[model samples]
Target: METVRTVCTICPSACGVLVRRQKADIVGIEGDPESPMSKGFLFPKGLSAIEYMRHKDRILYPMKRKGERGKGGWERISWEEALETVTERMGKAKALCGPQSVIMLRGAAKGLPDILLSRLGNAFGSPNITSMGFLCFVPRVYAYNATFGCFLYPDYDYPPATLVLWGVNPSETFPPLFRRILKAKEKGTKLIVVDPRRTESAQIADLWIRPRPSSDILLCLSVIHEVIRRGLYDASFVERWTLGFDRLERHVEGFQPQVTEPYTGVSPEEITAFLGFYTQGPSAIQEGNGIEQSLYTFQMQRALYVLEAITGNIGRPGGKTRWGNPKLVERYGPLFTLQDLIPREVRERRIGAERLAPFAHYALPQAIVQAILDGSGPKVAFIMGGNLLLSWPDSKRTLEALGRLEFICVSDLFLTPTVMMADIVLPAATFLEFDSIHMPPDFTYFAHVQQKVCQVGEARSDVWIVNELAKKLGLKEYFFKDEYELYDEVLKEEGITFEEFRRIGFLLGRKEYRFYEREGFRTKSGKVELWSPDLESYGLDPLPKADPSSLQSDPSYPLLLTSYKPYPFRHSNFRQLDSTRMLHPYPLVLIDGKTAASLGVKDGEWILVETRKGAARAKAKVDDVKERVVVMEHGWWLPEDGTFLDHNINVLTSADPPFARETGTPLLRGVPCRIRRL
Candidate 1:
């Protein structure tokens, strides 16, 4: 048996793992004993590595669709044939649609693939290349980018003061993290959870504010109003480190605690009490699921940051601090080797102008998907690395738009539902057969060595596939000599050497920047912009506030429908991860026990659910889990049982833009809907 030390890319948690293989086949998998995050243990999903490699669904060779799109028919092709076909078809698309038409989409959150995807896009003369950042975490990234001049998350070291949770439930989504959070809580960090559902984490909190979904901005604004009105804010800090104070002061003039209540459902007293927590210095405002997944996510995150900024609690031991390590960070310090290498004319009309801020993605993937559907700037798409069903705005809409693409090329490891829409589908290497440097999801700074543990019949890494295409299309010099050469180029200024990365499978750099302390913001004024010049430049309102509240518009869709990453899985990433799949054999919609009683819905029963966009059915999970909502786990595809029923949540999700808010991201969570018995 040959044992390899690598990290699991199944999810962003970045668990380090040890994959033991019998020759070219995986035999055993376990957590890296020396891993700082999981500490030598693995989540069940990671433990099932062998099973994942041996699963029946894994694409073992390059397959050309034998019939029409979504027909589930394919014929195996040799590497030469596959590459030639891709080169010819994609070249035609590029020649007709312009290089801008060919886009690169990432499926995995692990940073390694980005290096290749970006390179592939650049070499192929395409300017549009993106990941799921826009849909999931880019809002937080954008907010920090706009304000604090950094995207470093606070070090979450809540000690003495209150820990305010703005609707995030990391406990259930990441149980291993929950265990650590519990330990932190046990040491006297006060917990305050703000979510519509009384989740397990909220139940343990000192205070829980279950406001109506999408009312987060309103709730945060009301709290800010209270903090300012009660003379509880750190006024001196605001004056020194931030700009647009006067504008914000004027903007919030009309939004008193009472005015915000009808929208947020949070009482003035609760707002008053929550504001009271900040007086005790050295606290952190960790945003919850609600704030992070909504339309106004960026604004909500900024509002939460305001609490920290105004309190002057940053850079101190326990507050949301600031971080910056120039020699180390892969994202910001200096552009990596392949960054901006794409030709100027090719990048002239940046396709994602609606959702992104120039080269920086506000939420690139989510915005670009809309751009594709709208035919903004460019119209064709060449997707790699990302699974649209799981990461984009709405699965059904994405499928529709893909069908309309002048040409669509899907490079993936499986014939997933998303792949079913591609005009040309290419079988790519699974993570197990790929060699790339991975970053840890939890720790944020650590890097890992991801080596191939087994071979998938003739499947090659997406890196090789992309590089081959670039060469065939005649961009030889722009492409990498090999994976090793690419790493050398990318690592040119990023400091970490391949030698060092391979030794321990992880390398830790110095602690990064914390909350705004002597912080220089990135906007025109170079201060934390309460009302940014950047926003004003876009001719949009600079300061964020609650959306017009009077429109609880749709009467037919009465309940707010939303989804979250469940503990057993990380969206579709783990669908084929055997251990995690066994946890939930079929997708189910979680309904509150009280709500189910009112609707005469019982546990484990299938029911029909429809929204204005579309309709589907999911098994009802009526339990004492939480209340006032329907909780369907995000990321499962609609089932194909030959019955007249559907299973995917994307079918019902809306593809509307400005649902594409907060700088190009769409509101994927907290969707408003109503459910009935089938």
Candidate 2:
């Protein structure tokens, strides 16, 4: 038996893992004790990596649909035939309706595949490459870039005096960060958790501030007001390295804690105490997906950045700090994605680009669906590593839109619901079966080598498939001959081959605090923009503000519905694995005991959750949730039963208008809904 050091790609944590193998069979998977980031911490999902790679239902070869879309019948086909069919369909669509007639869709941003997909779209002169980013972390990315010109990552090395987990339960979503927070807590660092539900993190927090769902912006503004009123803000930093502080102070005048208490569901006294803890010393606020899925995603994130700045948390030890990528490595950006290949006119034609300036070249999923149904969207779609039927909102519409497509191709490890609708399906290798470079997403300044311990039956890496597809589409000059050549080119500046990088295992970038001191923040005025001129230039609000009236209780749909990702899965993955599925036997709708009693719902009883859009059923889990709020699990699909929509929370979600203007982020959270025992 031999053990191979690699990074787990099941989720974005990219935790270091050791895959023990006997010849070609994977024996066990565990956390790498030598990892600098995780430090021997491994979640259940990482531990089940072997089960996922060796699943019986995995698609081992390329296939062509034998009958109508959504039919299970398929015929095994050669890679050459699969490529030819895909190239023919895509090229035909391009010839008849211009290159913009083909759309590329990806799910999670798992390292190189995202870049490769974007590159393929640009090289093909299409500007409609879409991903889950609109509803995920893209809003935060936009807010950070527009406000402070960079991402603010927590400095785990320098434990914060106080850590504020705002709308984030790192305990489930990010175990590595949660472990660090626990260690910091042991060392006398105060912990404050801001979430509507009583999460594991909240239960252990030094202080738990439960605000109303979608009222986080108002809560943040009130906190800022309290901090300013109490003179707890950093006067020195504000005067030296911030812009529009006076406007921000004036803007918060009407949003006092007393005024916002009713709307935010947080008391003035609690807000004061929250401010007291945060302003105690060097602090870090970790924002999560909770705020990113709201109607006010951009404004809410902007408010958080303003809060961090006013508290003097930015660019300090044990506080939020801007980071740079590792030296001599290929950075994932416009240059790497070959953004220049697509002309300005093609980019202008991107769906929803006219309204969302920050959307840039990517298309919104809802807009893409609408365009397809209206005969204006791409006729051919090439989806990589995504299950739109389960992940995207408005499932009925998504299904209809996909049916309207002239041709669809999917690349995945298994035959997912989305794959069921594909004209062709390409087998994709799991992280353990592929050799590639893995980088942690969003502020983790590190890159590592993912070693291929074994290969499954004819499965190929996304990089290999993309390069081969590019070659078939007559774009060979822009792509490498093989995956290794691409890797070598990416590592050229580092003066190391892919083999050498594998031996090195990982490369961590130097973490520099107060980077703005050498050069001011990367904004128009070269300082943190409390009120952004760039936003004004983009025809958006220059300052962040939350409308309390938007939170008024809806009489028609009295209860609020929200969703959370369970610990055992990563957005529609791992449900097929018996080991993981046994841990979470049923999709749960977590409701407060009082609410469940009122709805005549008992524990473990299946209940119908109805929203303005539609309804879905999930098992009732009476828990410590807010009285009028119900939290359902997102990404629910039963592969064993072959029922994808019955339990999917997206069926109860809307992709309608009133989206966040900046990022086109749909309201995936805090939607008005009601429930009934099934």
**Which model scores highest in lDDT?**
2
User: Backbone clashes per model, in order?
Assistant: 23, 0
Model 1 CA deviation exceeding 4 Å by range: 1-3, 21-27, 157-160, 276-278, 324-380, 440-444, 494-496, 512-526, 576-578, 623-628, 638-645
lDDT of each: 0.67, 0.88
Query: RMSD for each model, in Å, please?
Result: 3.3, 1.3
Q: Per-residue error at 264 for model 1, in Å?
A: 1.9
lDDT of 2 by residue, 81-191 (tens): 999999999999999998888999998888777888899999998999999988888788888988888777987668899999988898988888888888899888999
Q: Candidate 1, residues 399-455: lDDT per residue as tens digits?
A: 666766765667776667777666666777756777777754334566667887767
Candidate 2: pairs in clash: none
Q: Tell me the TM-score of model 1.
A: 0.90
The number of the candidate with the highest TM-score is: 2
